[model samples]
Target: MPAAGRLLAERHKDHRKRHPLLPAEYEDEQLAVVEVTALWESESASGAVLLEDSELTGYVLGAPKPSPVWGPNLWVEAAGQAVREPEHIRDLYAAAAAKWVDDGRTVQYVVVPDDADLLDAWFRSGFGAQHAHAVRPAPTTRLEPPAGLKVRRALRDDIAVLAELDLVLPKYQSRSPVFSAGELPTLEEALADWEESIDDQDYATFVAEYDGRVIGMSVGCSVEKSSAHSGLARPDNAGFLGYAAVLPEARGHGAGRALGEAVMQWSADTGYTAVVADWRVTNLLASRTWPRLGFQQTFHRLHRAIGY
Candidate 1:
C-alpha cells in the first residue's frame, strides 16, 4: 500500500510539473496512502498489483457500482490506480480486466489524470474518453446576456421551467453519438429537487429569461457537495457548476455562455477561487462550450465494455 501511494504521489507531482494550476496539496504521499487503503478495504474491491524484483511497480483496483444505470459496471475511481511507468498501466489493467470480466462486470470506467502519456497508455489498453472533469479560475465580471435576455436568480415561480430545462441535457445525451442510457428523471422528480434546492444555503440557481419566459437554467454549489469531484484534487475553495441547460430555441442567442459566466461570477462573489464542471465527452455542445469558457481539462474518465 505504501509503495502504491508513493507511486501515486510521484505521478501527481509529474502532473503538476506539467500543469501547475492543479492542486499542489495532493503531493503528500500520506493522502494517497489513506485513499488507497480505503479503496483496498472496500467490500467489493478487486485489483492487481505489479511487482518486479519483489518491489511494487504499479497497481489497479475497482469496485462494482450498485446503480442500475450502470449495469454490470466496475468503476476504477480517481484514486484507484498508480504506476511507476505509463506503460506499466497496460499490464496492471490487463490483470484487473480479467478478474473483472470473469466476475460479470463487463462495463468498466477509469478516472485518469490529464497526462498525455498516461491517457495514451490507457487508450492502447482499449479505453476511450467517456467524460471529463475540468476547472477554471472564477471570473470577476459576468458576460452580458444577449439583447432582450435577462439573467437572474431562479425563483419558486420558475420551478416548472427549471424542471423542463433540466431534461434538455439528458434527452440530448440519449440521441445519436452520446447514447447515455441513464434513466431520465420525471418532471415530478425534477420539480421536487428544485423545490428543495431553491432556498438551500448551499445552492445557487440561476435562470435566463427572454420576453419574460424562462429559457435556460444553471446550478452551482461547493465542490465538496459533488461526489464525482470531491474525491479528486481541486483548488482550494472551489465551487462546482453542477448543471446548466438551455432550450433548443435559445441555442444561438448565447444563453448557455451567459449562464456559464453567471455561474463563474457567482463563484467569485461567493469567495471561491475556481469553479469546476464535468460533462460527457461525446456531448458535442458541452464538449465545445466548456473548453471555450476557459475550463481546462484536468481528468478524463476512460471507458471500455466487453461483450456488450
Candidate 2:
C-alpha cells in the first residue's frame, strides 16, 4: 500500500503540474495511501498490480457499487488506479477485466485524471467519456443576474416550484443525445426532497425568478456531503454545486448562469476555498455551460460494457 501510495502521489503531482488550479491536498502521500488501502482492502475488490525489479510500478482495482444506475456494474473509483507508464494501464485493465467479467460484472466505469496521453490510453482500452468532475476557485464577487431576473436563496415557499424545475434536466436528458433511461423522480418525491434540503443548514438552494415566478434553481452543499465529489477528487474546504436546472422557456436567458453564480457566491461566503461540480458528458447544455463558467475538468468518468 505504501508503494501504491507513492505512485499515486506522483500521479497527483503530475496532474497538479499540468493543471495548476487543482487542489494540493491530494498530493499528500499518507492520504493517498489511506485512500488506496480502503479500496484495495474492500471485500469485493478485484485488481492487478505491476511489479518490476520486485518494486510496485502500477495497479488497478474495482468493486461493485451498492446500487448503481447501470446493471451489475463495477466502479474503478478515483483512487482505484496509478501507473508508472500510460501504456501499462492497458495491461492492468486486461487482467482486472477478466476477473470482473467472470464475476458477471459486464459494465465498468473508471474515474481518471484529465491527461491527454492517459485518456488516450484508456480510449485504446475501449473506454469513452461518460461523465466529468470539475473544480474552480469560488468567485469573490456576486454575478449579476440576468436582466429582469432576481436571484436569491430559496425559501420554503419555493418548494413546489423547485420540484417542477427539478424535472427539467432529467427530462431534457431523456431525449436526444443523452437518452438516460434512469427513472425520473416524481414531483411528490422532488417536493419531499426539496422540503428537507431547504431547511437543512448544510444545504443552500438558490432560485432565479422572473416576474415573481421561479424559472430556475441551483443547489449547493459541502463537498463532504456528496458521494461523487467527496471521494478522491475532492479538494480541501470545497463546496459542491450538486444540482441546477432551468425551465425550457427560460433557456435563451442567462438564468442558469445566474443561478450558478449565486451558488458560487454562497459557497464563497460559506468559507469554502473552491467549488466543484459534475455533469453527464452527453448533456449538451451542461457539458458546455459548466466549462464556460470557469470549472476546469479535473477527472473524467469513463465507461465500457462487454457482452451487454
Q: Pick the candidate with the highest lDDT.
A: 2
Q: Each candidate: what lDDT? A: 0.87, 0.88
- Candidate 2: how many backbone clashes? 0
The TM-score values for the models, in the order shown, are 0.95, 0.95
In model 1, residue pairs whose N, Cα or C atoms come closer than 3 Å (at least 3 residues apart or on different chains), thus clashing, are none
lDDT of 1 by residue, 117-193 (tens): 88999999989999998988888775667688899999899888988998999999999789999888898998898
The C-alpha stretches of model 2 lying farther than 4 A from their native spots are 20-23
Q: After superposition, how far is residue 143 of candidate 1 from its true place, in Å?
A: 3.7
Report the C-alpha lDDT of model 2 over 1-308, residue by residue, as the tens digit: 99999899889889988666666777899988988999988879989999999999999989998676787899898889999899999999999899999999998999999988889999999998999999999988766786898998888999999999989989999889988878898999988988877798888889998888889999999989888875558887888899999999878678888888888888898899899999999999999888999999999999988884
Which segments of model 1 are wrong by more than 4 Å? none
**Residue 39 lDDT in candidate 1:** 87
